[model samples]
Target chain A: MEIFGIPAQALYGQLALGLVNGAFYALLSLGLAIIFGLLNLINFAHGAQYMLGAYVAWMLLSYLGIGFWGALVVAPLVVAVLGMALERGLLRYLRDVDQIYGLLLTFGVALILEGLVAQSYGWSGMPYANPLPGSVDLGFMRMPMYRLVAIAISLVVCLAVWIAIERTKLGAYLRAASEDADMVQAFGVNIPRLIMLTYGFGVGLAGLAGVVAAPVYQVSPAMGSNLIIVVFAVVVIGGMGSIAGSVIAGFGLGLIEGLTKVFYPAASTTVIFFIMILILIFRPSGLFGSTR
Target chain B: MTADTAMLSVRDLHAWYGESHVLHGMTLHVGRGEVVTLLGRNGAGKSTTMRAIMGLMKKRSGSITYEERETITLPPHRIARMGIAYCPEHRGIFSRLDVQENLELPPVIGADPLTLDRVQAMFPRLVERRHSPGTKLSGGEQQMLAIARILRTGARFLLLDEPTEGLAPIIVKQLGEIIASLRTIGFTILLVEQNFRFASGFADRHYVVEHGRVVDEIAAGDLAAGSERIRAYLGV
Candidate 1:
């Protein structure tokens, strides 16, 4: 059978690949949304942090002889500590300043991190050994076991984060702090500490996405730089601080991009940006953003 | 007033928002278990006084002694932890959260915190709409949630700013009753109100503020005799 001039088998294959890419998009954008929502500062260094996650994982394996499973546990924690220090030492000072300064500062930090990694690893990508090495056939298409695992894990992580923020008392404090920090502080929550932890948690999510992406894609310093632009476009389409919106838009856009590749191969690269533009023109706040 | 006797005492408190000086030599005191009101017209620095006392203002000077401890330089959170709670003029309810979530959001500080059931029983209307988000609540309900949320913190001193602003007369009456009940429960209240009549009944003593300074004070018993002067001062 064929649909829209494409064979069903080929279509299914593309859809599976799209879902894999969507998993990454969803994870990365979710981090961006969380950081932006609470801290009210755009973290331009998120892509670098994602790259750092992959690098930390690579360092663990190459130097310390730690395997993928260990890297999965160790890498995000390392990145989270680094992120917390960055927030405490630098971002905390900029809290009272203009938002643009924060963007510029983070952009500078990203450039510094990327430049350092390039000096050490070089621009060329490094190969990562896939921990889950197998394929599962769903009749219409054969999906790689690792890719399936990535999709399932990403979904679980996203759902867990959603539940933590929506249903828990800590989540309520975070949501309230985002709305009015002073009021939350008046209620005796050390808001500055919360803000610091929030930034750390957000960047840690990016790091987690990095660890997941390392095996699927080549682990390179430039890997995050390549993926982050697309992720930003995804966030814009989803709505800036909307968590659910980020998850849905991330996966949906990935699938759409996958379908585009099958129909119009050349348009796949630009498809997300085009959709973002269209969404912005109609719904200025994006799909799920409340008017601020 | 001596700082030892008062629950909260501010002496020559001056504060600023950036370069624009707002609170100038504002002094006030609230005794333990007394409901005091700061009555003033718009731009009279009533709100600034409240913000300064809560340590929300960036630049502040002079002695803000709470429980005999100097708190003028303390951060808002630290000051709050010392058993002082502030409900801003805007009510400061988190519209994104449900009423129950909003009430439960604040960390319970100190001892003798009001339980959720106690708060709910105090405002049965809040219990009925606990699941509703703050934005969906009526003005009076939001105000009740705001006050109730702070009451959960076990903060003995409550700073209420214009709680009745923009509420209907009936709602204002309801809020007044809640405030009166809070007093009966022994909460020390420092209230700021534009509605002179609404505050006059509840407050034990009234301080008149003008240009960030306390210019006149009227005890509750003297309210009737000082009405003409207060009307002239408040222009109400």
Candidate 2:
């Protein structure tokens, strides 16, 4: 069978790859949305955190003789602790300042982190040994087992986070805190602790995404920087801090990008940005964002 | 009165909002089991006084003694934990949460908090709309939910900021009755009200605030004789 002058096999292969990419996008953008929602700050270091997760995983394997499974559990925890420290030591001080300063500060942090990693490991990509080193025939294409696992894991994580924020009592506090921190504090909730934990959780999600991506993409300093721009675009298209919106947009855009690759390989890279522009033109607040 | 006999006492309370001084040496006291109203016009520092007492004002310096403990330098949460509940002018209801969830939000600060059934009995309207979000409720319902939510915290002292604002006459009457009933059950209230007529009927005493300081205090029985002075002070 053939569609758009491309063989079905090629289309399916691209779709599978697109889904894998989408899973990462969902995870990263979900973190971005959470951080933005609670902290009201754009974490430019998200990409760096993602890179740190991958590098941490790689370091665990090479230096500590830990396997991929162990890195999967430990690397994110290490990065999350780093993220919490960064939040407490740095980001909390910038709370009352202008939003632009926060962006610049995080951008500077990203540059420093990336610089430090590049100096030690160099820019060349280092491959992590794939734990799931096989492929499965999924009727249309031979999907890599690791990619499939990544997709499943990412979906579960995204869904779990979404439920925690939207449906639970703790989530109600988070949503309320995002709106009015003073009011939440007045309710006798230790709001500063909540904000710190929320920032850590969001960054932890980014770290987890990095761990997942290390097997598929090379563990390199540029990996996070390379992927973060696309995730940002995904966030914007999905509506800045909308939880479900980010997840849906991430997966949908990934699929669209995949289909575009199969149809016109030249436009695949720029497709998400083009869609973002279009969405901005029509709905200035993004798709799911309230005009506040 | 000393802090020993008073439920809440603010002495020489001074507060600022980032270089702009709002409250300058303001002082007031609420006796145990008393229903007191801080009556003043807009921008007369009535709200600022409440904020200062609640520790919501960042640049506030005052000796706020509650239950004989000086709460001047305590954080808002700490002050809240010390059995003082503040319901701001905006109602401060979390719009994302349902009425039941909103009511359940505040932590219990005292040993004997108002049970859910007791609260529901006080405000039956809340029970009818327990599943509805805070923003979806009517103005009267939101006000009830706000007052009722704090009741669960077991707070003996309530700092209510203009609870009757923007409500219908009947709703205001109902709220006033609820406030009156609350006093009978032993909740010490410090109400900030603009409606002098409504407050005069309900409050045990009225403190006339002007430019961040209390210029006059009138007992409930003397309100009729002090009406002229209060009207001139309030400029209502």
Candidate 3:
């Protein structure tokens, strides 16, 4: 049967693909929101860190005979340590400066990381054989098992993160620190150490997204650079530092884009940007964002 | 006056906010378990003394030795961990954090911490406002919350900057009684008070600050005799 002049199979297929894409956007933007919120730094190296995640995973599998499961555990840890080093060695020095300097530093880091990887791996791409090769048949469409796993995992992680930041004691410190870090410092909390750990955690989230994307998307340097813009658009529309907003907007926008593709294929690519522009006009802080 | 029993000693403590010098050799001391007051007007460097002692000022110099340990060069967190808690002039109640969260956010650092239950009991008004956002509280409630938050840190010394400002008379009385109780239990407090009469009722001594230094000193016993002199300093 056809739904709105399109076969159910094709329509459901596009929706599933969009959700898988949304999975990555949700993870990446969630990290962006976190780093931006606590550190007060716009981490432009987020895309490079995402690429590093995929590269670390690829190296694990190709060089050490580690599988996807092993890479899943190891990649984020490695990247988190690297992220902590970056914060300690570089970013912390610029903490008291204006936000623009932090943004530019991260931008430089992203360029250097991407450049090094491209020089080594070649700019074209590297293919990663899908680990979960089988597909499950639904009433409307047959969905790949890996894509389903990815969607489910991303949603669960996004929820877990939201809880961690909103419901826990450590979360209270984080929220309070974002509001008045100087007060938190005077209250006996080691703010500099906390900032470093938070930056690592956010970078680790991006790394986790990259590892998850390797088997489905091309395991290449440009892979993250190609997708970061869309993920940023999702962050902007959702609200720059709102965790729930970013998560919801990530998946919500993906599904909306999916619907647009089915209806007007020409506007699918530009639809999120159009919505972002509209949000900027009416609510410059973005939907769900407060003045904070 | 003597460093022998002083829990906090400031010798020629000076600090700067960028190029503008704020604290100019501000010298003071709070004896163990003594309630001392820094009495001054708006631009008299009272708050800057608190900040400098707590290591919050970026350009603080001269000697600040707390518990006989030199803290002039220590970072704010280090000074805080050394058992000195600073409740800022503005109260610093985060709008985003609920009352309970704000109370619980400051980590309990040292021994003999005031349990949350004890704090809640002390400030009975906070019990009902536990779930409300911190800024949702009334002025008196926010001040009580800030004081309560620092108590949980187990700090033996407290730096309270203008806690009675913008507060009701009843709240001020309650805070005065709490300070009396704190002193009885061996807690040293260095308070900055714009309300001279309220502080005179509780302080063991008063340090009269002007510009950025302590220009005069008055013992609690001699307050009545120096009442006119103190009033002149306060410009009241």
lDDT of each: 0.90, 0.90, 0.90
lDDT of 3 by residue, A1-292 (tens): 8998998877887788889888889999999998888898888899999999999999999999898889988998899999999999999999889999999999999999999999999887787678889998875678899999999989999999999999998888788888888899999889899899999999999999999999998988888878888988998999988888889999988888888888889999999999999999999788878775
Q: Which residue segments of model 3 deviate by more than 4 Å?
A: none
DockQ of each: 0.87, 0.69, 0.88
- Candidate 1 wrongly placed segments (more than 4 Å): none
Q: Report residue A161 deviation for candidate 3 (angstroms).
A: 1.3
Q: What tens digits encode model 1's per-residue C-alpha lDDT throughout A1-292?
A: 9998799888988999899999999999999999989888888999999999999999999999998889988999999999999999999999999999999999999999999999999989898899899999877678899999999989999999999999998888888888888888877789899998999899998888888999999999888889999999999999999999999999999999999999999999999999999999999888888778
Error of 2 at B235 (Å): 1.9
Per-residue lDDT tens digits for candidate 3, residues B1-236, read 79777889999988999899998898888898899999988999999999888888989889999889999988899999999998999999999789988888888888989888888899888888899999999999999999998998899999999999998899899988988888887889999998988988888999999999999999999988878888998889
Give me candidate 1's TM-score against the actual structure: 0.98
Worst 10 residues of 2 chain A by lDDT: A283-292
Q: Each model: TM-score of chain B?
A: 0.97, 0.97, 0.97
Candidate 1, B1-236: lDDT as tens digits:
45569888899999999999988899888899999999888999999999888888989999999989999888899999999998999999888899889888878787998888988898899889989988799888888888988998899999999999999999999899999999999999999998989988778999999999999999999977878879999886
Q: Which candidate number would show the highest lDDT if scored against the true structure?
A: 1
